[model samples]
Target: MGSANVASTLVYMAERCTSMRYLKLIHAHAYRTCLHQHTVVLGKLFRFVAVSPFGDLSYAHNMFDQMPHPSTFFYNILIRAHSHSTTPSFSTLFFNRMRQNGVAPDEFSFTFLLKSRSFTTPFVYDTHGAVFKFGFSRHLHVQNTLIHLYAVGGVTLSAGRVFEDALKVGLDVDVVSWSGLLVAHVRAGELDVARKIFDEMPLRDVVSWTTMLSGYSQAKRPREALALFQEMRFAGVWPDEVTVLSVITACAELGDGEMGRMVHRFVDENGFGWMVALCNALIDMYGKCGCLEEAWCVFHRMKRKSLITWNAMMMVCANHGNADDAFRLFEWMIDSRVVPDGVTVLALLVAYAHKGLIDEGIRLFESMQRDYGVEPRIEHYGAVVDMLGRSGRLQEAHDLLTSMPIPSNDVIWGALLGACRIYGDVDMGEKVIKKLLELKPNEGGYYILLRDIYVAAGRTVEANEMRQAMLASGARKTPGYSWVEA
Candidate 1:
């Protein structure tokens, strides 16, 4: 084949190549045809391997290394790929090597580096300096990336300053810029500021809308999030997987199964049923909405499942009092060679507790470290204590608490105190009140529980004294409220 024919053929093959094996075959053909030395052809192959979803980054790096003369374009592609890959720090590593090799970074190189999750604070500042020194600081894309980076790192102030400066100077601001600022405010927990920015935006993309929705969700304003999701749909903006997931979460928080089912239908109609993240969100939505049967159906139908899948399903079962089912699913998970993490162990313990299986819960708590290699944390200890206390084994629970390897926190102590009230052990209840008062004198819960215990035991005078103590302690009972969708 002529050189032109060979290069054209390689390009055509690279475009259509889906498998690495096919790409390798084409590379061998290029090598035999003496076209492997061509930078354009090599760049295409490198781009395909670096950016394509089917591409392997390690293979791309190996091929890049084999090139006798790597171009700046090839270096940027590799850096960009690494920035988004699992090991984002490799982007900086490659950039440093590029600098050592005297390959000056283009605007794209710095832009990708700025988006890296692994960039340290000092490194970000240094890159900021480099952007100015290289005269790319004025580049709109680079500035937007800097805003995003700062926002993601929880440095909202710096991001806001950058965005404000850009707008003050009348720099060409786009949806991304506005969205970044909005997200930065959301990350900083400045919800009102974020909403103002959202309202002021000249144009809002799906990302902009989604950011506001997520901000509302994060702020625990599920009602507002759902309202925003409806507004987004009414605006005719197509919801992506992320937007759909956020909406489902809002429905979960609202415990609105009707809304959740609507989102589920939308997901299925939009062909996101195969997206694992979205499916997982569906499972969570159903579970949170008190639809355990629907959640299990989704779980069983999932062709590909992650560890999170098992944990979520198990938790839902445990929460709904399906302890035997949760344990059976856990056994099946172990049989399938899916290694259980701490979440899985915790869920099973919760299941045991829900069923009031004190002995089984204790055995599992003790065996977690030995069998699953998952060490018990304070939360696990609390669960075991709560379980034993709920089972009316007050002394055993107290003994376990006293013998705990870790110091007991207010949660564990409260668990025991709660049991003291349930079992009406005035002696133990009074002792618990003394310790609880010393630990947290300001808490109204311990005082209220003690007062209830005294009243239940027919000690009206002591109950009156406890009530007076509560009043003098300056601790007021916080009002409790519940929500239901009309």
Candidate 2:
């Protein structure tokens, strides 16, 4: 490569490479090569590296501090990097600094700023005035980004306004624009809207079909995703890995083995049987749909088994109430040199917990980190906690919560709160209940737990208070029922 190209790439990597280590190596090498001596060269270099792995707010501030008069070009790069950076306060800091620096903000600069604030709906509106201040509301990429922000934030109407504007500008709307809108439609649970978008696609690519399929799956419209799949097949759109995954998951949800078997045939005929994910999904589909034999067949037929494959089988066994088979499968999985994930241990512990073998459950739960080196997620914790709760070791369950490295979330707290009511430990139950109410104020289960705890403690007045709170907040308790093929 020429010296000019090398210098340019050095600038680009500094500005764009997300990995910190790679950026540092490049930075070190360029420093040695004197590629960073030129002010223009170093300025571009710092901008590209702004969001790289080693980049922090200090690095950006240092760059700006050293420059005599940082232009919009410099601030734009800094602002853009801040968008991808980990700190929100830093973005706010830089936005405040932008006005003080007397640097004129550009479209790219504002777009990233708006994107950084996209998580909060009200904060996003604040960025809108700034976008208009920079006069970039009409830019196609800027508008499209806003549409996506709106769609993700669950405001389909606001999303539509952006899409309509994109059309008015005759700004060649691509599949991404359509896909984003479809996702928003899907999130709204408007399957008809998703279907309309699917039909209106003048051109449907893999993502276009995949989006509709996923939308159908999410909204519990598996049949529609399946129909779209059939249409995709007829239209000769080559199904990628995602298409097969959606179809398999849809078949699983349908719980029709005969239908699942047909999908199996289609998958095999398409020569996708060798794909690990497809195999995993097929096993899951057949297992859940009561075709355990087919699931085992698909699992064994795979040339290689992934950790997910083993974990999926374990889950299937546990779900079918075949705890013995589940444990045996876990043993085989361990012998086969696969490092188990949190799912595997949790499934095994749950099986043991169900059988009331508290010792076995405890052993496996402890072994998760000790033997497998896999850190337990809340699912793993929940299984063990529920085990202890059901077995009437309420204090032990509470102790587990105390011992956890992280604070309990709603599900964990809810389980313990449920345990308190079960064992009639009103005081501890109230403690869990208070935490739940404080953390997840809107969770209906907290009120239900509060009432149940009061009732268990024979405090009728407190129970009435909880009921009144539930009514006042309009928090409906989720059904605490489960079906076991009864």
The TM-score measured for candidate 1 stands at 0.86
**TM-score of structure candidate 2:** 0.63
| Model 2 regions more than 4 Å off | 1-40, 51-61, 120-123, 168-172, 256-280, 297-310, 332-346, 349-486
| Candidate 2 lDDT (Cα, 0 to 1) | 0.78
| Residue 347's lDDT in candidate 1 | 92
lDDT for each candidate structure? 0.85, 0.78
The best candidate by lDDT is: 1
User: For each candidate, what TM-score against the reference?
Assistant: 0.86, 0.63
- 181 in model 2: Cα distance from truth in Å? 2.2
lDDT of each residue in 329-422, candidate 1, tens digit only: 9989988899999999889989999988879889999999999999888889888888988888888887887788887788788999999999
> 423, model 2: CA deviation in Å?
23
